[model samples]
Target: MAGRAKRLRIHGRVQGVFYRAWTVETARGLGLAGWVRNRADGTVELVARGEAEAIERLIALCREGPPAARVERIVVEAAPDEPAPEPFEKRPTA
Candidate 1:
């Protein structure tokens, strides 16, 4: 079965707070595949692909990121072209 993919642009106090690392751990734990990276604009961007349920779970968790994150909002959209890299990873800042 094909999996679902979503690109998320998280805003507010997300940079330099280990958000990418936290996302990698969370996505991996949820058996997801994709990549997370920090944007130069001070936002955290990630593409998560996996079971639809798992994707939703990941989004919900993202709203309350790690202890250091003060998530203000998350803009999510379909990511039809984003590759599902196995074992999730934190990519270099874009």
Candidate 2:
């Protein structure tokens, strides 16, 4: 499978809106591996690794998160150094 990895920072109405859980579910459904956490700065951060197309689909889903989430923006960056080998998880607040 074609693989790709990325670190994403989601902004605006992300925290306290089930964004992390939503992300975990979404990523897992896409068969991606990574983790999602809430940032102290009121953003949601995620690291995802999987098939290039699947990862892109997951990223797109992040752009329009859960029903309660008003995802304003999502900053996606390449993370070629770190890789994950499990299903998505919801990490503790940071």
- Top-lDDT structure, candidate number: 1
Over 4 Å off, model 2: none
Stretches > 4 Å off in candidate 1: none
Candidate 1's TM-score reads 0.95
lDDT (CA) per prediction: 0.92, 0.87
In candidate 1, what residue range of length 10 has the lowest lDDT sum? 80-89
lDDT of 2 by residue, 3-88 (tens): 78899999999988889988888999999998999999999989898888898899888888999999889898997666675878
* Residue range with the least summed lDDT across 10 consecutive positions in model 2: 79-88
Best by TM-score: 1
Local error of candidate 2 at 80, Å? Answer: 4.2
